[model samples]
Target: MNVFSALRAFRELLPVLRPEWRGMLWSYLIGTASALSLAGLTVLTAWAVGHAVVERTPPGPLWWVLVIGLVLVRAVLTWREMDVSHALAYRVLARLRMALFDAYARSVPGRRREHSGYAATVAMDDIEKLEFFYAHTVAQLGASLTLFLASLVSASVLLPEAGLVVLVGGLVVASSALYRARAARRLGEQEQRERSALSTRIVDALGALREVLAYGLAPRIIAETDAATARAAAIARRHELLSQLVTAIRELVITAVVIGIIAVSSSAAGVLAEGAQARLSPAELPALVALALAGVAAISDATATLTRLHPLVAGAERVATGIGRAPVVSVPERPRPLPTGPLGLRFRDVSFAYEGRRPTLTSWSVELAPGEHVGLVGPSGSGKSTVIALAARLWDPLAGTIELVTPDGTGIPVAELDDAALRDAVALVDQEAVLFHGTVRDNLLRGCAPRSDADLTAVLERVGAAAWIGLDDELGEGGVRLSGGQRARLCLARALVRRPRILLVDEVTASLDPATEQAICDVIAGFPGTVLVASHRAQTLARLDRLVDVTDITGVTGVVPAGRTGGA
Candidate 1:
């Protein structure tokens, strides 16, 4: 990345703050007041000191009052500026997090290519690193520019020579920010990559802790993590060295500007030329120097802020990319409501494929009658899961339509239905029975309407989970504390809590013991609404009313009945 690219990245991200204009305005105003007050204090003290020393005049009560008041005002303004800017930054961060989450929700598992850990890193860590950009960069830069312009005008009015020196020196200091710009951006990007990779490794290790421990790979994992950390630290050290070099150059320029102002002030006061008429009074010399330095320092401060932004450019770009990801499925412009009553599922000549892979379903069609129970049976990797996912609208088929068929045989395309209505009508429980880190009730109530304790207890009882777990019992992260069967039952109860019109299960019983599997199958066997279970397990399929083989259903284009094969 270069300066231009960094600026473009920020340009893409800055629009997320449009809704916060009022807060941004307040932040800018407070920041400007703070910077001006500090400059005013410096100039006022210098003027009083010069007057007393060079003119033999004691300071008046008004001068003392102004100095004291400026100090107090500067302190308050400084604190208030931080409060407002940080508050505004956090609000923007929250919105960015939500925006990223929404993007992931729509775009994820598209081709199943994105790593969970990398996605988490982008959402949490990358977004967090942008706090400095949001909180300190924008309004503070504006405030610094405002102070520089104010001081320049004041110095020019006092003495044109002093103002000219300030302008030249400010430009030099500002230009220092561009020093090693390309190298800084490259190192920053490398650092970001290393950090994200390290986070991903750690997350992957934690998620597969049992396998790692079982294979005795802990030492190797630890060594690899240490190496990654060292690499990241080295990159950080290089960035720091470059920043320090720029700061050193900036400080040297500021020091030289001060010396130049002193010389100009002394010459105007007739100190360097004997018997020359004094154009500037000796008493104003200190104040003139102070004003010049303040003006130049403002420019330096702004440039320093810009220099620090190089390290954050990569993070900004990641966040921007994550937020702007192309959605896997398009939302309907005008969504039609689902029909009122039990709904069946219909796949019409559907053709789908994962990225870089052959088609999973080719011109295939299948349907379940309303209130009928059907089992989808096929060999492993025969697109049973793909069929279930399409019916649930996780991804749309590349060619053809999947619909929710009403009792009267009217088919409403799943893509055309309102998102909420579609979600309400269909529920899916897959092989990986995921339970979040929360109370049993929290996981069950996710995406469900409010349910009373009695209603929840009954659902848990239906799944045979009420015997071992209470509604308020905490399930550790990913239900680590629960047995496999227990987790499966709770997941089933969660799906049941929604009371969806169509229940889609995908090989959820493949790994369970025979007894537990039969217990789960019994619950599905009793569901009254339309049910479609995809499994290779004979016992699980035995509970359904009929079976449809995925391999036999491809190359067909019409509604195939639950028990029969269709023509190619």
Candidate 2:
């Protein structure tokens, strides 16, 4: 992106700082004071040295005291400024992370196509890269500019010619920030992309480590990762080289400005000409040169900060995009309350499709009576899971409405209901049972109200998991220690702990052994509220009250009936 585009991206992030304005102000003030004190110290020391050398006058005790005091004060302010700015930056980053997570929560699994690894990289690594922009850029630039302006004015009062030299040199140093701007930004973008790709690869490999090892692909994966790392390192080296080159140019400009100030002061003090009138005192020459150097240094510091921003532009843009992603479903402006009592589900003329894919459902219509147990059966890719997901409100239908129905046939569209209310009433247990790395109790209580150990144990016993798994049993990451049947049972227990009014199961029995499958089906059959199971397993379907063929449910005129017998 160009400079203007990068500026706009950063502008979008400014609102996050509204609450921290006081901290930002204090940081700027402290930084400016610290910078000015250093400049003052440099000029005072130069003036004292020149006075002693030119006029045989020793420095007073007050001069020494003033210098020592400035030293101590600058040191304290410098530390304080850093502390405040870094703290403010960490707070902003924390806020950004939460915002990004919310965005993901609302928008993700919509298309079900985003790479988990890449999304993780954007959330963690890319956001972390923005610390320099938040902590150093704004307040430090202001401090540098203030120091430069103060030094420039002092130099002009002492000698206009020296001020002119300082101004020219400062302009030169500032312009160096724009040197190779497009190239630096391009390199930065490339580096960020490479890093994200590497992160994705590593995450994918680790996630499928078993498969990688079984297929004997570990060597290939490692080789590819090494190559990616090398490419990323090369890009970083190039960026550093470019930054060093710019620094060299800035240092050269500062050096030339110092030389110009010395010449101007010498000529004005009649040190360069035999009979020239002294426009400046000999003792002031050193102070004038010091002032010019200080001004140039301030501008150089500001420019250096700007140059660093070119590389950070890519990460900033990524973070901004991630935060501003379009949610899969919009929250209602005035959400209606969920219907009272047991909640049944009805999909009325509902139609949906994944991104760039054929329609999964077309004008589909179906209903589950309150407290009824129904099974959805279809061939692979026949939209069984899609129906389950829609019932759970993972994504809104592209057309038509899915509603929560009361016993009286009053229907409230899911889209118009409050999100929390919908989530509270509906629970989903899909085929892929995910158990986080924590105690079984932690996973069970994830989104539910607090439950006593007795209550939790009762639920686990209902799912036939209490025999092997206790409430305090530690489930390694993703329940790696458990068998497939064991994981499925725990997942069921987790859902049962919520005691939801409606439970949606998607192929949860497709891969389980008959004993586990029968156990899970028994629990669903006994649920007091509405139950919708999408499965092709004969044993699972046979237990349901009726079965509906998902392939033929769409484009039906009225409430879809169980077109096929469960055992058929």
lDDT of each: 0.86, 0.85
TM-score of each: 0.95, 0.94
Once model 2 is optimally superposed onto the true structure by TM-score, how far is the C-alpha of residue 460 displaced, in angstroms? Answer: 1.4
Q: Residue by residue across 222-257, what tens digits does model 2's lDDT show?
A: 999999999999999999999999899999989899
- lDDT (tens digit, per residue) of candidate 1 on 483-508: 88888898999999998999999888
lDDT score for candidate 2 against the true structure: 0.85
| Lowest summed lDDT window (length 10), candidate 2 | 559-568
**lDDT (C-alpha) at residue 409 in model 1:** 96
lDDT of 1: 0.86
Instruction: Record all residue pairs in model 1 with backbone atoms less than 3 Å apart, i.e. clashing.
Output: none
Best TM-score among the predictions, by candidate number = 1
What RMSD value applies to candidate 1?
Answer: 2.9
For model 2, the superposed segments whose C-alpha errors exceed 4 Å read 109-112, 554-568
